[model samples]
Target: MGSVLVIGSFNVDHVWTSDRLPRPGETLSGRYSSGPGGKGFNQAVAARRAGAATRFVCALGGDGGGDLARALAADDGIDLRELRSEAPTGTAGIYLDEAGGNSIVIGAGANADLSAAFVTAQAGAFAEAAVVLTQLESPAAAVLEGLRRARAAGAVALLNPAPANAAVAADLLAATDILTPNETEFTGLLARSTGTRVADDAIAATPDDRLHDWCRALLPHGIVVITLGGAGCFVSHADDARRGEEAACYRLPAAPARVVDTTGAGDAFNGALAAGLTQAPAAPFAQHVRLATHYAALSTERAGAAAAMPSAAQLRERFGELFSAG
Candidate 1:
């Protein structure tokens, strides 16, 4: 087992809990609260709480949001490596409806200022990590640099291309050892990478074999894991040098939980997967995904992003039956 490293962004999230999502030109009032968030930050916290020795790297501003990130990282016991910039700290406005669905708008701020050079300076972290995880919340240059360095170091490079509305570079996709995306992000990636428009939810209800075929078409190499909410996750393993047909596919059932806020469930899955990889590197790959899936389900039972992550004790207590160690 080895360490997990997360290179991403940290933002303070402002949230509104409403009865329903407001449509265009409609204004609605709801309960308001602010907390720690940012896909990178949330994932780092999740990894730490999932029982791994985790490190987080990101750029934070000098404002109150930055200070808040620092304090939260300390409390979570996550090894945080942050670069300081002149810009204000990043932020996100999240709207959560009664059904636990959410819509978000991000303000990059200092997150946009994170440079490739900064990531390069911390090359040793990527080199020493067993798993190096990154997302699109930070600058593209920085994300690519981190992934390249991680791959060069022979570490498992995991890429989660979130906020699917943006275009991801080919080099980044090609370098990834593992790709995790939701339905929207998968469709967006295929459209951007190969000009193939696979309709949204085209294979959401299909069998693992079908999902594997689609993932193979999208990425001939590397591992692909797509989260399909309550239907669970589809994982295709094409990392072996054998033919694509030899690749194995797995479907892990989603854990049952009382839903509250789904804002951070994906981050929880990514983080817990990274952590689980470190905790049991020699175990079957599906083992890691199962632990992560259960952890993510529990995350939705809570309300806030980072706040929703279960502690190591809580995860084991609640989802221990699914843990490989059990």
Candidate 2:
């Protein structure tokens, strides 16, 4: 089986679960917890549990935070390619509410030092990948190099542009085969690509045809998946069979989940989606999306980032029909 390569970050997540999120200048008391997380690390764990043969590449500091990352990856049976650096390991501050909502802030640390040269040195990994997954937590040059390497090797390249406010290079966007973004990131990407102000509500409210039109203008040869919390996800893929302006679009309903903390739901979806794509290369794109959505729903039932990912056995036991049926 060709491996799914995840090029991203590794961070220690500090979490506070409270009745409600804190407001400006207000310090609220809440339960506290800490664990390993980072978009790259979280997604890699999700993919591994989703039953994909996976490898993860990231920069790490020579510290206890990095030690935790190594330990977790080892337990998950992941192939970890670590690049040690002088900076401290990255970290995230998370606040979770009783309503399953979350707010987070990140300290980039070693994640910011994933140089393009390092990615280029890992050429063999990219060449052997069936799918290449990345997020914006790492440096831009490194992210761009990873996408380029994946595309050059004919592997499916998926970009989950998170931290919504970051600006992505045009070349990086052009190299992407699949772009997964939450509502906020969607708005940001569109605004940057079109040089016009984009409102998040307008995107959620637009009809399918209009959305496809925007997708075509943004990426002519790729797919765009916009994940809406409760309304489910909207997918638009470029159709080669059609001429000038045409694409396929669909809206799937949200999967049932007993909500806990929604901290890593998006990472779960992207990882599971990548796993499904790698495992069933011939299956319809919609089927992968559905499986990913269901996988994400299951993830939210638990309360941590990487720790919340459900294993293949759990998925089979709970969602038997999901994988066994057509």
* lDDT (Cα, tens digit) per residue for candidate 1, span 1-326: 67899999898999999999989999998999999999999999999998888889999988999999999999989888999989999999999999999999999999998889998988768767989999999989999998998888888889999978866888888888889999889888877776777787775876677767778877788889999898888888875822233448877788999999999999999999999888877777888888999999999999999999998688778866567433
Q: Write the per-residue lDDT of candidate 2 for residues 83-183, one digit (tens) a residue.
A: 89999999999999999999999999999999999988888888789899999999999899999999898899899998798888789898899999888
Give candidate 1's whole-model lDDT: 0.88
Q: What are the root-mean-square deviations of the candidates from the true structure over C-alphas?
A: 2.2, 2.3
TM-score for each prediction? 0.95, 0.96
Q: Judged by lDDT, which candidate is best?
A: 2
Provide the clashing-pair count of each candidate structure. 0, 0
